[model samples]
Target: MLNRKFGYVFLLALLASSAAVGAEYKGPLDVPAKVNTKFAQSNRLTAVAKAGNALVAVGPRGHILVSENSGQSWEQVPVPVSSDLVAVRFVNATHGWAVGHDGVVLHTADAGKSWVKQLDGKQAAAVAEKSFKKAVAEGSEQAKKSQDLVTRFVEEGADKPFLDVLFLNEKEGFVVGAFNNAFRTQDGGKTWEPLFWQIDNPQSYHLYALATHAGELYAAGERGLLLHWDRQRQYFSAITSPYQGSFFGLLDTGKELIAYGLRGNVYATADGAKTWRKIDTPAPDSVVGGALLGAHYALVTVGGRILLNKSDGSGFDVIPASSPMQYASVAAASDHSLVAAGARGVRVETIRDQAIQEK
Candidate 1:
């Protein structure tokens, strides 16, 4: 009987190990129909912003897809290099920056008419080191991790070192990433400075989201590592997060801030970071990212769930978007017209027209 018990235990252990390996292959299982296509097999979507009457979405392997007349139609912009793009912010209808892999930063002055490579992180660090005010590797955890990302994976069909960027305007912005990498630029794309010298455990921290709310910069990363900017010193400091999973992105609802993370991890704070509480999500899969639609509505976007939204009193309702969004991401205009970005370098525009009145 004892031997029988031991055998059962051994089998269970093996099964558990297998499950962990499978979990890392996390994917959008029930992707909406619209984003599923051969050309748009994008993995990590980093940048989605509105430009003029167009919506631009940028992502891995130098993928830039522009949607003219909202997100109803898309066209690919052939980038000069095969770099992974992670984030896009438009200061106005014309000026913007898209940041991504290999320390790459792209800028467009003539709208989407042209793009120029502004600065690479590796190159920026070298330049910063020559300056008298070069900030020494802060010896913080972030600095240590930044060094570990010197080499990146280029596995075919796999997502590589992902990043996130935010711009208060075309000239001043910051881009952050996995391996504790962070860069700041004040003169648009003229030059950049490393926020921290290195990040500890270099490759351990996978940053997924960044946003500025109420004059404070907030960053969220793997295992729920949250950081806030200290304006006086111009650096980031660690803060307590409610979960241990990676935060894909954040939703600023004005009255509340929702810090959404892996596997349905969504935490809300009413009085800023003084306190946080988890909100229940209807979906069971890990949420990769999301954004606000309007004053009383939000989209619970993940890589797989094309469009999930929470109406004022109706709770969570899937968006009526026709396209099946796979490996999806979501953003919203101030007017609440929803724009989703993701793999295949794709973007979709949607709006809540009306709901059917049931008998």
Candidate 2:
């Protein structure tokens, strides 16, 4: 599948060429990931998460790395498929999920040491088809549209990739991706139900991120699309978006919610997204990932800059990287160090105490 997300053009080009090589060639979704003991540390990594005391990061070609002593060092782990992994999240030290290209979803119960495939694009399409059929039979108002979607899903095959995965607990979570594709799992990904029709995305915008704050779940995506899950209604309701650019991720600072994305656009809302105020940031690049670092929030840019929230929460200050490079994701280690994964692989940096100035 060709991902329209920024920074994935190279990956799509590589896949296109591979497909032209031979008819017997297997797609990354079905091919097992190759182990590279010597060069695993240098492979491009897209996302990182803290698994208790351990750190897990994933990236293109199904490369997964685990760091035991914070992010000081990393070791590659075996994965089932070679599909590009875009995002990963851990509910606890032992339970975590990773999702990416080819609609791949992988789960690990033993921290990041091992993983098993929970779903793929082919299976996901089948799930959506089944759900759509039921909706049509029940005479749902959106029946006609649902039927069309099923036909598209069947024709698309396994090309749609899940961009992000979120789990509220070990048993409850959601995965959202290109063209408004979404699914929910209540049994720890044992089974997933199609959730497209439950959201207010009639235009089928690609959902790039999912976040929760104060028990409220929100989704953000292309064209400034923002959605809030109405628990009672059991559907995702649209919220007024402050920017017209794609939002790559969200940050929950415990006190407020931040939606950040393209061209350094960042907005915060303290009243459950009912209102939002823009937060000025120095970096002009897209903010790809963020994490709450102790009392401060850290945001990483696609241009390799790290920005930290001021202690007073008034604004953000840029912290220059030792060796600047494109960064895709960042996470806070148990020891309060910062670990970032991206085009140049994984890097660990300990934020200087003075970087986050006190009010």
Candidate 3:
């Protein structure tokens, strides 16, 4: 569940571990990722999505799980890489893409039943290096720094991770990740253009979430990094954020735009980014998962508590899970149910009959 919330913490941990390596390992990029026979469905999953009537979840070890009967039973789907998958998006019932560590991007034509690797860190770094070098040669100051960044990417091998992905349809899509790594594909997964230079991310902050609000695309990430699609320029422009902390998830409840992140910080804007007001939570724990439950917004914290807010932003409540499982991502499976994935695997929660217990 590498939504905006979990991607930052997970990527930081991954970077910390990879930093211990003395040098980059440029091994075979085409090698198939390993598949564990057992515990595939029970493994820690980062994100979940609804594909028609089916539920798809992805996580560490390139694991992808699908459950046609909601979250009750899941079957593992074979993947081509060993990278940790963080985020997944399904445009319709069948077409979708999954992104993960090592800058890995995978595509599925038949929903989550089968997949093919579209791109990975090996090719991503190469593409970036070439593009940045070209920019440097043209005397672009930004390119000079971009070259250094991509050079480090090459040195780090496939350690980088793509935190989030979004597809406009079966063909047009985008994948975003740490250090301003973003790519766009107009011809399905056949080709991708490096978008690192297009956005207003001068600091190269990690782009954690890619979403659509009011029929417009938006991205949010580290240090209050917020961006909205500029259709005319074919780029994402920076949006003014009310909070300076990292935002982990973006939710559009039709009536309002919500950006939530570290330390239970939730801000809402009904007039796009022109105005924002804080929707205070009960605790300081990070909000790792969220969904639009009917007329309210339900946000799940990493501390295993679910926070609920009214559409008018007038009421708030907290409901603790029965177990202490650290939830990562959640999706509205139905009008009354939510499917969440995280440290304890995937679970279906019934919210209709649950009483609102304010904290």
Candidate 4:
């Protein structure tokens, strides 16, 4: 059985990397992605996001596809690295970032047409080590523990992968990944500072998703780990999690925040994480990704299920897909249709009453 906490691509990549342990090989991090003319028809896309009116989806082998006509057609772009990109986010129409295996981060200034590599696992580990060492020298209370963690990071080398990326705007953003790896960039992707010591994750749980609700930055990950950025304290503080299972994604419904993950567990909070209410879902499959439509919300599951709810986070109903396939992430397009990225590829579907009609 697949682990509900990690995405299918993520787990597969980890296993593949492990199997190649001592082999002298050139990894995805060093190689550039090969351009495929049939990428739109064949690539296994994992996540989708809206870059203004354009829809962008990313997947294995650094495949980044962009569609301007609401997912009607797509064009594969050039990327520097072949690392399997897991998640992508655009602050606006022109600036975006994608993160994936090998802790790779790619930036695009011309929307999704072109991209350049930024921080990767090797650089991330070094940054964390330096930051932690400085903190320890300053005699900060948590510095010693953080230093120890970074020491391990340095020893382990560049095998970690970043699962998600979030940009508050063109200048500020964060990238999070496995083993509590995270970094923040103030001047876009120019430079990044390690956030290992800034987050309160002592167990080093893998962070799967990042979301912002009402000006607060939140991260959700393995074993129900949920954290919100505390500007006053200068670090992320843990929220009281409602479930013990892992959370794969977070959705901000304007009126409430929803955290959904393992075994179809979904919880909503309208009071800023102070308390949570269990929301009933139709299937027990993990809810992997979701998007907020105009007045409704659409959530997709790994079992190829779609859950729709109102903006207030109520009236949950299952919107069956015409051809069910495992989904990783979803985004609302300009035509009000849902663009889903999953095992098969990027799929365009529309919701009519309670059924999703594929386009």
Candidate 5:
């Protein structure tokens, strides 16, 4: 996981040098990911998702661990690629996808038991370069950037990573990542097409998070980059951001929209991105992850602080943790508590009205 005191991509790339950006990437699809039985579950995990009743977490070295009983114990599963997996999503218990470094995407048919490579950076780079070559003839600022990307792909073969993924169902989904990377797979991973050119990202900044509310999809990223999918138009349009800093993650509480990132900056949009109101935060640390607990929402910061806010427009209050340690992601446990994992491994805590049962 990218550990940022203040959120951004390049700094994360530097910290994850061993697994990220490779000049000699052998095309992740060509190189099958290896499984190290000894270190599978022990490696750093980035994200976790609930597959029906089972909880699955993915991380560095292609580590995927599945726990059937609310993270009490875990079992490592075999994955095809060794590229670091950052985000995972499941439309149903039996259908899911995992995306990671090298733009690798994996699909599973049997919950989290096994996975197959669906797309990789090498193929994505080829497709992107093909599209860029056409733009190169137009001779504009975007064209120049496209041409440069083509040259980079020719030399590097698509080593960029997909940081987060969203699957609305078995057939429709989107995967987003660094450097304006986004793709759509409508046929259940049978095929994927690049959607970078369709969005209004003239600067081509990194896209960090994807969220959907009331059938509306929104993407958040660097330098206040925001995109909203126009179902009627069949494309994502860039929306003006309330803040100019990078946004690391986004959430839709079915009542309000929250875009969070650098320096504990967060905003809420009840009427979509048309207008936004900044949520008064309790700390200055970056918001790393979030979870919906009933009518309340929990936001976890980089320094392991938990902030609680109501979905019905209440001010945020800091929920103290047992220990002040870094946490990368947050999920609601089956026991009605919250499960957070990061630098100090997994920690489960009971959140009351304003107090917490530290564990």
Candidate 6:
């Protein structure tokens, strides 16, 4: 089993070695009649979303590639700039947002037929300046020690660095990140208001994943932390988990919910996220993200491999794929069709028409 804990040497070996060009895989895959060979080497697969019959993959430096008719043929949609897009979410075909490093955020209202930059990296410039001014004000022995603190804020975004985003609808959504960065939007992402709590020497913790189910929101990240805000608490409660890995992706299977993390950490809950059960899998490939298709099924990116893990109402099987995913993430169509994608711009398809137990 590939369950690489952060401190486990075996997990480290798996993470470092799994992405090598020659990882062997004997899983199900689609051999395109005419594949887009150029995308096979891309390290830009950050997130995947199902759009119509098309599977849209987003990645670093403004790379957006789409495949219609279930990944048989793909064409690049001309992106406006070369910004490193870390994650994307489509509410429908259009009206979605992608967030990434820096304060970069992009929006597409036309089903990614086109996109426009909504936020820029400039917002973070204030973080560096504020640290500098504070350090200068304490120019003594304390100020000398403050130098390290200031550098931390300047370099590591201890002041403000956002991680994941969740839009409940086009009108209402939320974003959380480092330095206690939290914001809520009520006007379809048109505007946002900060949700901050003052602290002495605030630090940074990147919000790794955000999910919504049954009128509640959940966000989890580093230190085996899980936070849920619902009708009562409306604030995050620190929930403990069995593992210490960062939970990166979540799926609301309606019947049951699945939350996964680095390496092969999966926690499943039948009555929502109330109680979770652990499941074994192959390789701890840091499944950074996922997409739920239909019910009881999803497409997930593990380590750097894509697996169409299936749920027959109660349990899930990591239905194999044909090859090692060049990238680390994948998405499904609205119909649960698997589209594995990754770096070097690689993409492979597995439609519902394909059997899960394929030899």
Q: Give the whole-model CA lDDT for all candidates, comma-separated.
A: 0.62, 0.88, 0.82, 0.86, 0.79, 0.59
Predict model 6's lDDT versus the native: 0.59
Residues 1-359, model 5: lDDT tens digits: 44565466776767788565575556445555566644665556788777888777888777787778777777888887778888887888878889999889999888798999899888887777666666656654554645554566547866789999998889998999887788898999888877766677877799999999777999989998999999887677989889999999998888889899999998999897889998888879999898887667788988778887844464677887865568778877653567776765556667764443221
- Which scores better on lDDT, 1 or 4? 4
Which lDDT tens digits does candidate 6 get at residues 222-331? 75667676546345655556667777767776655567887767777665466778876664566666666544355455445554555443334565556655455667
What's model 3's lDDT at 291?
83
Off by over 4 Å in 2: 1-24, 357-359
lDDT of 4 by residue, 1-359 (tens): 56665688798998889879846577788788888848644658889999888988999988889898998888888788888889998889889899999889999888788899989889888888787878778887776767677888889988889999999998889999998988999998899898888898999999999988888889999999999999898799998899989999998878888899999999988888999999888878999998987677888999999888743444477776766789999999843579898988988887774332221
Candidate 3 Cα errors over 4 Å, as ranges? 1-38, 133-145, 354-359
Please name the candidate that would achieve the greatest lDDT relative to the true structure.
2
Q: Compared with the true structure, what per-residue lDDT tens digits does model 1 show for residues 198-262?
A: 32223357767787766677888887887777777666767777887778777667767678767
Q: Say which candidate scores most in TM-score.
A: 2
- How far residue 4's Cα lies from its native spot in candidate 2, in Å, is 46
- Where model 6 places Cα greater than 4 Å from the true spot, the runs are 1-43, 124-162, 178-180, 196-203, 231-234, 299-304, 308-316, 334-336, 351-359
TM per candidate: 0.73, 0.92, 0.86, 0.89, 0.83, 0.70
Better of 2 and 3 by lDDT: 2
Considering only N, C-alpha and C atoms within 3 Å, which residue pairs clash in candidate 4?
A: none
Task: Give the alpha carbon lDDT tens digit for every residue of 117-232 in model 3.
Answer: 99998888788777777777888765565666667777887778899999988889999999888989999989877877678888889888988878789999999999988999
By summed lDDT, the worst window of 10 consecutive residues in model 6 runs over: 26-35
* 2 or 4, greater by TM-score: 2
Per-residue C-alpha lDDT of model 2 across residues 1-359, encoded as one tens digit per residue? 44556448777888888888876778897787888844767868899999988999998889999989888888889999999999999999899999999889999999989999999999998888887888878887664565666688768898888999999999999999998889999999999998877889888999999999998999999999999999898799999988999999998889999999999989999999989999899989999999989887899999999998877667788886776679999999843568998888998878776665452
- For each candidate, how many residue pairs have backbone atoms clashing (under 3 Å)? 28, 0, 4, 0, 3, 25
